[model samples]
Target chain A: MSTLAVAKKEFHDGIRSRVLAGLTVLFGAFMAGAAYYYTEITPPAGIQSSAEPQTIAVINSLIIPTYILLPIIGTILGYKSISGERESGSLKFLLGLPHTRRDVVCGKLLGRSGIITVSVLVGFAVGGLALYALTDAFQIVDFAVLTGVSILLGMVFVSIAIAFSSAVRSSTIATAGAISLVLVFLFFWNVVLTLVGYVAQELSLIETAQSQTPTWLQFFASLNPTGAYQTTSIYLLDNGTRSVPSNPPFYLEEWFGFVILAFWLVVPIGLAYLRFDRTDL
Target chain B: MPAIETIGLTKRYDGVTAVNELDLVVEEGEVFGFLGPNGAGKSTTIDVLLDFTRPTSGTVTVLGEDAQRESQSIRRRTGVLPEGCDLYDRLTGRQHLRFVNESKDADDDPDTMAERVGIPEAIDRKVGGYSKGMKQRLAFGAALVGEPELLILDEPSTGLDPSGAHEMREIVQEESARGATVFFSSHILGQVEAVCDRVGILHDGELVAEDTMEGLRNAMDREAVLTVEVNRVPEDAIAAVRALPGVSGLTTDGTTLSAHCRDGAKAAVINELEAAGASIEDFGLETASLEELFLAYTGDRPSRPIDKPTVAAGIDAAGERTEGHR
Candidate 1:
C-alpha cells in the first residue's frame, strides 16, 4: 500500500513537469508524421503500391522513429530518479515516512514506467488512427504488437537509467552515465560489433559473407536493447515478403530478441537494487 | 518503556566520530529538547534513530523496538520533521499532506491540517512557490497527521518567524498535553527553553548535558551573580562575604559589592554580609539563564583534566539524570 502511494505521488508529480509535457508533444508530432510518410509517401514512390505490404513493412517503417524517440524519452524520464531526489534533499523527507528503500526503488520504476506507457499509447493511437484512415488492409494485430513492444522497449531503457541513478551518488554522474548509454545503444554498439566482425574476417577466424554477418556476431550485436526491439518486432510481424533469409542457429533465432529485451529490463535494475538497498542514502 | 534509548551509540564517518559512545534516554509523555551547536552530531543522532544511517557500534531502540531491525514499525508510530531537507517541488501542500496521511494509513483532511499549521491560503499552491516558512509549516502539519505516539522534530523553528515559532511551540504544548512524547532538536536556546520539559545538550559528538528545566540549571552549576548595596563599605563584611562557601570573585564599587556564587549559595553570602553589620540598602539577584547554562556545559573547558567521566566517573556524568530526570 505504501509502495502504491509513493508510486501514485511520483506519477502525479512527474506529469506536471514541463519537461515531460514538451516530450509528449514532440513524440506525438513525430509519430503522426511518420504514419503519413508510411501510408502516403512510400506507396507512390514505388514501394508497396498495394496500399499495404506485409505487416512488417509498416511496423518496420515506424520502428526508426520509436527507436530514436523512446530512448530519449525514457532516459529523460529516469536519469534523475533517485539522485535528483537526494540532491534536492527530499530523499530524507521521503524516508521519514514508513517507506523502506525497496519501496522507493519499486515506486520509481512503476511511476516512470507509467509515464512512458501512457505517452507511448497516446503516440501509437495518434499514428495508428491516421494509418487506418489511409490504408484499407491495415493489420490491427501487427499494430497492437508494435505498440505493446514499443512500450516494453521504453521500459527497458527507463529501467537502465534508473539503475544508473540508484547506483551513483550524484545526478551529474547519472547524467554522464545516461549519455554514455545513449551513445552505446544508439550508435556505438553496432560500430564496435562491425569492427569486431571485420577484424575476425581479416584474421580468418570465421567465414563471413558481405550480405550477412556471422550468425553468432549478429546475435551478439542484437543483444543491445534497440537492436533487440528491432529484431523482435520484425520477426514477430514477418509475413515473408522481404528477400532477407530468416533461418539461423537456434540461439540466434528472432524470438531470442524478446529474451534479450527482457534480460535488459530485469538484470540491470535487479543488480542496482542490491547496492541501493545496502548503501546509505 | 522509554520513548527513545541508545546504549553506547557511536557513529563515525571515515575516522571522525559523528556521535561518540553516547547513552541517551527520553521518557514517554514529555517534551525533550535536543540542543547542540553546528557540527555537534545532533542530526547524526536523529538519523540513527530513524535508521537513515547506521551507528558504528551500539543499540538504539525507539519505543522499545530495535531501531535498525524494526525501523518501519518504529516509523509507522513516529512522526518526523527532518532538518536540512527539501520538500517536493511539484507537489502542492495539500498533496504532500495527503501523501503523508495515505502512507501512514491515517485519515487527515488537508484543509484542517493546513489550518492547524496556519497555512490554509498556501496549501493549494505548489511548494516551489512557497517561502521557507510555509514549507516548514506544511512539514509540521504532515508530521501531525497520524497523531503519532512520538514526534521527532529536528530544528522545528528553522525558517519560521517569531510568531510562527511561537505558534509551533503552542502546537508542541498541545501535542504534549495530549500525551505524545515530543523530541525536538534545536540550536536556538530560547525556543527550546519555552516548550521543552527537559533538554539535552550535545557537543562534539558527545552527550554533554541532559536534564529537566531546573535540573539543567543545577547540573551546569552556573553561578548566581549577587549584588549587595550597603550604606557603608565595611572591610570585614567584605571579608566575611568572601569566606562563604561556593562564593567567588568578590568586587565592590563605592557602597556596592558584587559576588558570584553557586546556585543555592547566594542567600548564604548575603546573610554573611548582614551578620558582619553592614546596613542593607538595595541589592540585586540574577540567576543564570537557560542560555548561560547551555553555554557552560557545551562551551570549551579544558577537556576535563583527570575527572573525564568516560573514564574516572563513568557512572556519574553531567548528562546522567541525577535528579528530576527520568
Candidate 2:
C-alpha cells in the first residue's frame, strides 16, 4: 500500500512537470514523421521500400531510431529519479512516512516505467494512425509487437538509469554513469567484443580461422538489452522475411531475447535496491 | 515506557563525530524540547531516532519499538517534521497532504489540513510558488496526518512568522492535550520556554543541562546582574553593598558600580549606595540571555566565533557539575 502511494505521488509529480508533455509531443511527432518518410518521401534504394509493404518499410526504418531514442528518453526520465530527490532533501518527506527504502526504489521503478510506457504508447498510436492514412497497410499484430518491445526496451534503460541514481549520492554522477552505460550498450558493446577477440587471438586463447560463433560469445551478445529488444521484436513479428541458421542453440534463439530483456529489467534494480536500502539519505 | 529513549547513541561522519555517546529519555505525553544552537548535533540525534541515518553505535527505541530494526512500525505511529527537508515543489499543497494521508492510511481532508495550517486559499497552488513560511506550514500540516501517537518536530518554527509560530505552538498544545507526546527541537530559549515541560540543552554533541522550566528560571533569577552609574564612588558604600544578603559580587570602577545579585537584592544595593552619599545617576538590571545561560551551564558561550583555551577545562568541569546536579 505504501509502495503504491509513493508510486502514485511519483507519477503525479511527472504529470505536473512539463517534461512529460514535452516528451509526448516529441514522440508523437517522431512516430508520425517516420511513417511520413516511408510513405511520402520514399527515400532511395537503400530502404528497399518498393519490395515490401509500406507498414513493414516504416517498421524497418523505425527500428534504428527506436533503439537510439528510447534509451536516451529512458535515461533522461530516470537518471535523477532517486539522487535528485535525495540531494534536494525532498527524500526526507518520503522516508518520514511509513514507506521503507525498498518501497521507495520499487515505487520509483514502477512510476518511471509508467511514464516511459505512456510516451511509448502515444508514439505508437500516432504512428499507427499515420501508417493507416498514408499507406493503407497497417499490420496491427506487427505494430503491436514492436510497440510492446519498445516499451520493454524503455523500461530496461529506466531500470539501468535508476540503478546508477540509487547507487550514488550525486545526481551528476548518476547522469554521467547512466548515459555512459547507454553509450556502451548502443555503440561500444560490439567494438569491445572485437577487441576482446583480438586480444584473445594475441594470447593464443583462440585460433584465427574460427569462423563459427562460439556458444559463450552468443550468450554474451544476447546480454545487451538493446540487442535483445531487436531480436525479440523480430521473433514476435514472425514475418519470416529474415533468415536464421538451422537448429541454432538456445542462446542464439529469439526466445532468449525476452529472457535477456527481463534480466535487464530486474537485476540492475534489484542491486540498486540493496544499495539504496543501506544508504543514508 | 518512555516515548523515546536512546542509550549511548553516537554518530560519526568520516572522522568527525556528529553525536557522541548520549543517553536521553522523554516520557510519554510530555512536551520535551531538545535545545541547541545550529550544528550542535540536534538534527543528527533526531535523524538517528527516526532511522534516517544509522548510528555508529548504540541503541534507540521509539514508542517501545527498536528504532533501527523496527523503524517502519515506529514511523507508522510517529509523525516527523524533519529539519532542512523540502517538499515536492511541482506538487500542490493539497496533493502533498493527500499523499501523506494516503501513505498513513488515514482519511484526512486536504482542505481541513490546509485551513488548519492557515493556507486554505493556497491549497490548490503548487508548492513551488509558496513562500518559505508557507512551505513550512504545509510540511507541518503534513506531519499532522493520522493523528500520530508521538510527534517528532525538528525546528518546526523555522520560516514561520511570529503568529505562525504561535499557531504551531497552539497545535502542539492541542496535540499534547489529546495525549500525544510532542518532542521538538529549537535553538531559541523563549520558544521552548513557552510550551516545553522540560528542555535538554545540547552542546558539542553532549547534553549540558536537562531541567524543568521552573528550575532553569530559578537559576536565571538568582544571577541577575545590576549595573548603576553613580555621581561619585564612595569607598564605604562598596563594602556595605558587598555585605548585603543575596548580593554575590560587587565591583567599582570610577563612578560606576555593578552588582551580581538575586532578583530581590537590587533595591538593597541602591539603598546602601545612596545612604553612603554616592548619589545614583542611573541604574539598570539584566537577566541572563540564553547565550549567558549556556555559559553559566557549560562555562563556554554557545556562539562559535570566540575560541578560548579554557573551553576544554570548561567542558570537563561542566560535565561534573551537570552530573552532580542530576
lDDT of 2 by residue, A177-217 (tens): 99999998999999878887778789887788899766676
| Fnat for the candidates in order | 0.87, 0.89
- Candidate 2, B122-171: lDDT as tens digits: 99999999999999999999999999999999999999989999999999
TM-score of each model, paired residue for residue: 0.83, 0.84
Model 2 interface RMSD over true interface Cα atoms: 0.9
Candidate 1 clash pair list: none
Model 1: residue A171 alpha-carbon error in angstroms: 1.0
- List candidate 1 stretches off by more than 4 Å: A43-55, A194-216, A242-247, B219-287, B300-326
True contacts kept of 2: 0.89
| Interface RMSD to the true structure, each candidate | 0.9, 0.9
How much RMSD separates candidate 1 from the native structure? Answer: 9.9
